[model samples]
Target chain A: MRAIILEQVDRLLAAQSGAAALRRLEAGEWPEELWEALEGLGLPLLLVPEELGGIGLGWADAAAVWQVIGRYAAPAPVAECMLANGLAAAAGIEPRGGFSSFGQTAPFGRFAAQLLLEPAPGRLALHAPGAATPGQNIAREPRDAMTPGPLLAEGALPNSHGPRALRLGHALLRAALIAGAVEHALALAVDWANTRKQFGRALAKFQAIQQQLAVVASEAAAVSVAVSAAARAVDSRGLEGASFEIACAKVVAGEAAQTTAATVHQVFAAIGITEDHELHHTTRRLWSWRDEGGSERAWAGEIGRNTLAQGGAALWPDITARDIS
Target chain B: MRFELPSLPGGSAGLRAELRAFLAEAGRDWTPAVRARSWMGFDREFSRELGARGWIGMVWPKAYGGHERSGLERVVVLEELLAVGAPVGAHWIGDRQSGPLILRRGTEEQRRKILPGIASGKLAFCIGLSEPEAGSDLAALRTKAERVPGGWKLNGRKIWTTNAHLSDWMIALVRTSPAPEGGSRHAGLSQLLVDLRLSGISIRPIRDLLGEESFNEVTFDDVLLPEDALLGQEGAGWAQATEELALERSGPERYLSSLPALTAGVDALRDVPGADVAVGRMVARLNTLRGMSLSVAGMLEAGEAPAQEAALVKDAGNDFEQRLPEQIRALLEPEDMPEDLRALLADLTQLAPTFSLRGGTREILRGIIARELGLR
Candidate 1:
C-alpha cells in the first residue's frame, strides 16, 4: 500500500511538477492543476482519521509522500495543507473544503481559508485567513505572514507542549522534504557527472569528482535515515514523546542539506549556477527549507543543553530509551 | 540507497538496562583515560563476564554456545557497551567477525572447535590482513602459504594485526598460489586459522599515537598449520575477507570512538558558555549515526549484504568520530577544564586519525560508495 501510494505520487509529480511548473511557480503563478491533482489523491488529509471524513495515515506514510513532493520540488502547499487538515481533525474542527494553512507564516496562506494556530499553550485555534503580508522563501514558495481575522474554532490539543510539538512537527516535515530534495539533487548531480564529458571523459571518471559525489551520497543517505527514523518515532510515540528523534532528524537533515547542496552544486559547476538547469530548484529549496525548521544550530543547542542537564550518566540511557519495539 | 529504520524487538529495553547496569558496576574502577580507549580497552575478565552472561555472540545459534538471540538484540548489547566505552577488545574480533565467519563457512570440526571457545570468551582472535606492503589494496598482499604433506607451511608478515600478541589465534589471509598471469590478482588467496603459539612465529607490538601497544606486527616463518586449518574454501579469501569487512565496518564502534570525550566534556562544561549547543550538535549527529548503524544491523539480520550501505555509514561515522574531539576542544576553556577531561581530550584528539585509517580508510570507503553510485 505504501509503495502504491508513493508510486502514484511520484508519477504524478514527475509529470505535472517538472522544471516548467517550477519556473511558473517562481514567476508567482499558482500551481492550481498540480494542487488539484494532489488533492484528488486525498493527500491533503493525509494525517486525518477516517472517521473525520479523511483517509487515516500515520506520520511514516506522510513522510514517504512528502519525500515525493520534495523530489519534484512541487510548488504547492500540499504538505502544509495535509498537516493543517490533520490538526483541524484532531481538534474536532470541521475540515475546510479549500486549503488550510498551519501557523501564521504558512505557505500559500492567502489561498487558505483557515489557519491553524496555537493561540495558547494547550489551545488550538482555527482562524480565518485575513490580510496577508506576502512573502517568499529562497525557492519562491509562499511564506505569507497571514493575519488571523477571527477565531472560527478552538479546542484543546491532545498533548501538553502544544506549541513546541507543533513546531517540531513542522520541523519534521521540512526534514522529510529536505531529505527528498537532497536525494533528488544527488541524482541530478550523478546523472550529470555521467553524461557531461570533460577532458575526453565523463566527470564521474575523475577521482576528485567521484569523491565529492560520494560525500553527497553519504549526506543524502544520512538525512534519509534520520527523517525516516524520526517519522517512525512519531508514529509509535506522539510528537512530545518523540521530541529527541525529531530534533535529531531536523539537525541531521539541515546539516546534510548544506553539505549536499554545496557538493552537488560544485558537481554541476557553471551549468548549476544558471537558472536554466534543474539543480537550483532543489538546491535553493534545500537552503530555504533547512533554516525553516529551527535549523541545525537551534536544535543542536537544545539537545546539548538537555543532555548536559541530564549529565553524562543519563546520555546513553536517554539515547537507548528512544528505541521502541 | 534508502535505509529503512529497523524496529528493535521486544525485550531490547530490558536487555539494554541489564547491560548498562553491568557496565556501570564493572567499570567503576575505570578512569577517564581508560574509558577513552573506547573499544581498544582490552580486559579479558570483562569479556569473560559478558560471555557468562550471554552478551557475546548473542546472535549465533545456541548449539555453538551462543544465546540464539536476534541481531537487534546483539546491536543493543554492542551499543550499550560502546556507549560507555567498555573494554570489549578481548572478545571484539572473535564475537564480531571471526566466529560468525567460521560458523558460516568453516567445516563442522572447525566450528565446533573455535566457536564455543569464542562464545565462552576463552579464546581471542586477530585478523592478519594488512601486510607491510599491502594496506588498502589488500590484493597486493604477499603473505604466502605452501601445502605440505599433511598441513600448510605459512611464511609471511602481517602488520597492524590488532591484539595479535595477546590472541590465541590469527585468521591469516595468505597467497595459496601465485596470481595467474594477466588474470585476477585476487585469485588463489585463502584464509588459514593459525595458532599464535606455533613454532617460528613472532609478534612485535607497535605503540600508537595514544601510546598504547594494542596492535602488533606478526611474522610467521614456516609455521606449520594442520590441514584442517583452512577456514573456508581455498582461493576464496578475497571474497570472504571483504565480506568480513562489511561486518567490521558497520558497528557502533565506528561512531562511538570519541563519545567518551564528548561525555567527559559535557560533564565539565555544564557551567560553561555555549557548551550546550556544541554538545547538542554532537548528540544529534550521534543519534542519526546510530539510526543508520541500526538499519544496517537489521539488513544483516535479514541476511542482506548491505556492503555499500555499511561503507556509507562507516565513512560518515568516521567523520563524526574524528570531529567530536576537535569540537569538544573548541568548546572548552583550556585553563578551566578539569584535568581528567583535559587528558581524555588530548588522547582522543591523537586517536582521531586512526578512526578513518582503521577497518577502512576514508578514501577507500568513498570509492566503494562511488562504485555503488555507478561512478566507477
Candidate 2:
C-alpha cells in the first residue's frame, strides 16, 4: 500500500515539476491537471467508506498521501477533499465527484465544485462557490473565502465529531504537509552540502553546515513522529480525547516548519531566496501551512489550558494513555 | 507509510500497568528533588528490588538471568521507571548498554560471569569512552593496552566516566595497535572489560554543577587482565563502541531528565493564570520527543541500526531537557512558586548544563547525524 502511495506520489511530482507548479501559481492557473490526476487516483475519497464507492483508507494512509503532496507543494485540494468526503458521509450527504473544499475558510474555494462548511457547532452545510474572493496564503496558494449564507444543503451533522474534529483533522493533515515539505527541505540541504563545494571541500564537510542541517533533520523527524501520534489518537478516540495530541502535534509541526524553513534558507544562502530555486516551493508551503490549521502559539495555549485542566498527577498518564486502537 | 511510529506491541499495556503499580508502591516517599534526577538517581537496593521483579535485563536470554521479554516490555519498564523517577541509575548503564554489549560480544565465559550479575542488579558498569584529550574525537584516544603474557597491560586516563566511583566494572575503548598503513584512525582500537577493583586503578570523583560526584576520572596504570577481558575481536573497538554509543544516545533518559521538575511545576502552577499555555507547550514538545524516542526503540526492536535517527533524537532531546527548567521558570511567576517547586527548578537548572555534555555532546551528535545525511 505504501509502495502504491509512493508510486502515485512520484508520478504526481513528475507531472507537476517545480517549474510547472511555479508557473501555475504565477499564472493563477487552476491546477486542473494536478486535480485531475489526484482525482483519477481517487486520492481525495480515501477516507470515505467503501460502501460510498470510496477506498476507505484510514487516517494514517491518507496522511501518507498528504505528506507526498506536501513534498511537491502540489497546489490542490487533496487534503480538503478527504476531510469533506468524511464530513459529507457523517452528514448523510453523498459526496459528489469533483474537487471538494472544506475549512472555516476553504482553500482553492473558487475552484471547488462543492464547499463543505460548519458555520456553527452541529450545523453542516454545502455551498456553491457563490463568490470566492480570491486570496493566497503566505505560500501564494489559494485560500479564498466565501460567504456562509445561501447554502445548497443544510442540516445538523449527525454522528459527526463536530467542527472541532474537522479543524483538528485539518490541523493534523497540515502538520503532515509541513512534515513532508521539511523532508524535501532537508534533502535539498543535504544535496547542497554534498554538491556545493567551497574551500576545496563539499559544504557538507564543514561542521557549521552539518550542524544546521542536523537541526533540520531533527525537526523533520520530530514532526513526522508527532503527526503520526496525533493521527493515531484521532483515529482511536474520535476527537473526544484527541485535542491534546492534536494541539501538541500542531505546535510541534508549526514550530518545526518555521525553524527548518529558516535554517534551510540560511544553509542555501543567496540562491535559496530566489524563486528560480525549488527550495521556495517547500519552504514557502512550510511558511503557509504552519499558520493554516492554527499557529503554533495558538495550539500551545490550547495545550496549556488542557494540561492545567487535567491538574498535576493526571498529566503524564494523559500523555502516555493515548489511544493505540 | 509504515514509517509512522509503531504503536506499542501487545502485553506492553499489562507491563505498563504493572510498573505503574510498582512505582506507586515503591516511589511513595520519593521527594521532588530526588525524582528530578530521573534515570540518574542511583539506589542499589531499589535496583536489586527491580531485578528481583525481573525488570532489569528483561530481554536477555533466561540462561543469563533474563526474563526473555520483548523490547516493548523493556520499554514499558524503563518508561515507568523514568516517569515516576525511580532510582534505576544503579543498574542503568549496565542494563542499558554494558550487559547488552557483553551479551553480544563477550565470550561464553564472560557472558556467564557478567550477565547474571547485571540481571540480578548486584553488578554495575560504567562507560570509559571520553578521555580528557579525546572527549568527542574518541578515535584520537591515547589509552594504550600493551599485549602481555597472560593478557594486556592497560595504562590510560578516562574523564567524565559516569558512576565510575560506584561501578564494579567498565568497558574501556583503548588503543591496541597503531593507526593502520592506510591511516585509518578507527583501526586498531579495541574494547577491554576492566574490573574497577583491580590494582593500579584509581577513581577520583569530579564534582558536577550540582556538587554531586556522579562523574569520575579513572586512571589505569599497568592494570593486568586475563585474556577474557577483551570483548569482541581485537582492533575492532571502534565498531563496538559505535554500537554501544547508539544504545547510550537513544534511550528515553536523554529527554526525561528534567521531566520531574516540569511535572512538579505544572502541578504547583495548575491554577495560575496562563499556566496552561506554558505547561501545554512543554507537554507538546515532550510528547514529540517521546514519539521520536519510542520510534527509535521500535527500530532497535526490529534489529535495524537507526544510528543517524538516534543521533537526531539525542541532539533534540538534549536541547529540550536542558531548556525545560528555564522555560518553565519563565512560564510561572517566580514569587508565586512553592519552595519545593523552586528547589526542583534550581536543581534542574544546575544540572541542565551537563545534559548536552554527557553521552555525546550536542555538536558530536549533530555531526554524526549530518554524516548520515550525506553532508559529511
Candidate 3:
C-alpha cells in the first residue's frame, strides 16, 4: 500500500510539478489543476478515519507522502490540509474539506476554506478566512496572515493532546519534508558532480568533492532515519507519548537541512544560487521549512531542558523508553 | 538512502528492566571517571557475570553455548551495559565479531572449541590487523605465515592491538602468499587464530595519551600455529576482515563512548541557566544515531551485509561522540563544577580523538562511503 501510494505520488509530481510550475505558484498563480489532482487522490483527507468517509492512514504513511511532496517541492499545502483535516476530525468537527490549513499562524491561509486554529492551549477552533495580508517565505510559498471571519466549530483538546500535539505534528511533517528535500538535493549534487567537468575532469573525480558528498549523504541518511523512526513512534503512540522522538527528528532534520544545503550549494558553486537552477527549488525549501514548524534550536532546547530535569540517571532510560522492542 | 525503521520483538521492556537492575547494582561503586571508560574498562569478572546471565553471545545458536536470543535482544543488552558504562571489554570483541565470524566460517572443531569459551566469556580475543606500516592501508601489512611441516610459522609485529596484552587469543590477518603478477593487493591474505601464550609471542602494552594501557604491540617470531588455526578459507581474509571491521564500526559503541561525559554534564549543569540547549542537541543527535544503528542491526538480522551503511553510521556517530565532550566542556566552569564531572570531562577530552581513529579513521570511512556513492 505504501509502495503504491508513493509510486503514484512520485509519478504525478514528476509529470505535473516542475521548476516552471513552482515558479508560477510563487508568482501568485494558484496551482488549480495540481490541487485538483491531489484532491482527487484524497491526499488532503489522508489521516481522516475510514468511517468518516476518508482513508484512515497511519502517521508512517503520511510521512512517506510528505517526503515525496518535499522531493518535488510541491507548491500546494497538501500536507497542511491533510493534518488540519485530521485534527478537525479528532476535535469532533466533521470534515467538509475543500482545502484546510492548521496552525497558530496558518500557511496558505487565503487559499484554505477552513483554518484549524489553536486559539489557546488545550483549545481548538475552526474558522473561515476573511481577508488576508499576503506574505511569503524564502521559498516564496504563501504564508498569508488571515483575518478569520466566523468560528465554525470549537472544542477542547484532550489533556493528552494539547499544544504539544500540534507542535509535534507540524515538526514531524516538516522534518519528513526536509528529509526528502535534502535527499533530493543530495541526488542533485551527486549528478552535478558526476557530469560537470572542471580542470579536465569530473568534480566527483576529486577527493575533496567526494568527501563533501559523503557528508551530505550521511546527513541525508540520518534525517531519513530520524523521521522514519519519529513517524513510527507516532503510529504506535500518540503525540505526547512520542514527543521525544518527534523532537529529535525535528532537530536532526533541521541540522541536516543546513548541512546538506550548504554542501550541495558548494558542489554546485555559483550556478546553484541562481533562481533558474533546479537546486534552489529544494534548497530554498530546506532553508524555509527548517525554521517553519520549529527550529532545531527550539526543539533541542526543549529536549535538553526535559532531559536535565529528568536527571542523569534517567537520561538513558528516557532515550530508550521509546523502544517498542 | 532510506533506512527502514527496525522493529524488535515484544517484551523488551522486561529485558531492559532486568539489565538495568543488574547494571545499577554492578556499577554502584563506579565513579564518573570509571564510567567514562565504558567499553574500555575491562573486567573479566563482570563479563563472566554477564555471560552467566546469558547476555554474551545472545544472538549465537545454543549449540555453541549461546542463549539463542534475537539480535535486538543483544542490542538491548549492549546498549544497557554501555549506557550505564558497564565494563564489557573482556568479551566485547569475541562476542561481537570473532565468535560470529567463527560461527559463519570456522571449521566444526574450531567452532566447538572456541565458541563455547567465547560464549561463556572465559576466553578473550583481540584483532591483529593493523601493523606499524599498515595502519589505514591494511593490505600493506608485511606479516607472513609460511607453511611449516605440520602447521604455519608466523613472524610479524601487530600494533594498536586492543586488548592484546590481556586477551587469550588474537585473530591475525597474515600474508599467506604473494599477490599474483599484476593482480589485486588483497589477494593472498588469510586469518589465523593464534594463541597469545605461544612461546614466540611477546606482548608489550602501549600507553595512550590518557595514560591508559588498553592497547598493545604484539610481536610474533617463528610462532607455530596448528593447521586448524586458519579461520575460514585461506586467501579470503581480506573479505572476512573487512566484514569484521564493518561489525566493529556499526554498534552502539561508535556513538556512546562519550555518553558518560554527557551524562555527567547533565548532572552538573541541571540547574544552569542555558545549558539545556547544548545538552538537548547532543541528546537529539544521540537518539537519531541510535535509531540508525538499530536499523543497521535490523539489516544484519535480516541477512543483509550493510557494510556501507555501517560505515556511514560510524562516520556520523564518531563525529557526534567526538563533539559531545567538547560541547560539554564549553558548558562547564571547572572551578564551579563537581570534581568527578570535571575529571570525566578531562578524561573524555583526551579520549575523543581515538573515537574516530580506532574503528576506522574518519577519512577512511568517508572514502568507503564515497565509493559506495560511486564516486571512485
Which candidate has the top score in DockQ?
1
Candidate 2: C-alpha RMSD after superposition: 2.1
| Lowest-sum lDDT 10-residue window in model 3 chain B | B1-10
Error of 3 at B372 (Å): 1.9
DockQ of each: 0.84, 0.73, 0.80
Report the alpha-carbon TM-score of model 3 versus the true structure: 0.98
Off by over 4 Å in 3: A155-159
Please identify model 2 stretches exceeding 4 Å from their true place.
Answer: A148-163, A323-325, B1-3
Question: What DockQ does model 3 achieve?
Answer: 0.80
Estimate TM-scores for all models: 0.98, 0.96, 0.98
What lDDT tens digits, residue by residue, belong to model 3 across residues A82-161?
88887777777778858888764678887888888878876778888777788889998889888887999987666656
* Deviation of model 1 at B298, angstroms: 0.8
DockQ of 2: 0.73
Q: What is residue A9's positional error in candidate 2, in angstroms?
A: 2.4
Worst 10 contiguous positions by lDDT, candidate 1 chain B: B32-41
- How much is the lDDT of residue B96 in candidate 1? 93
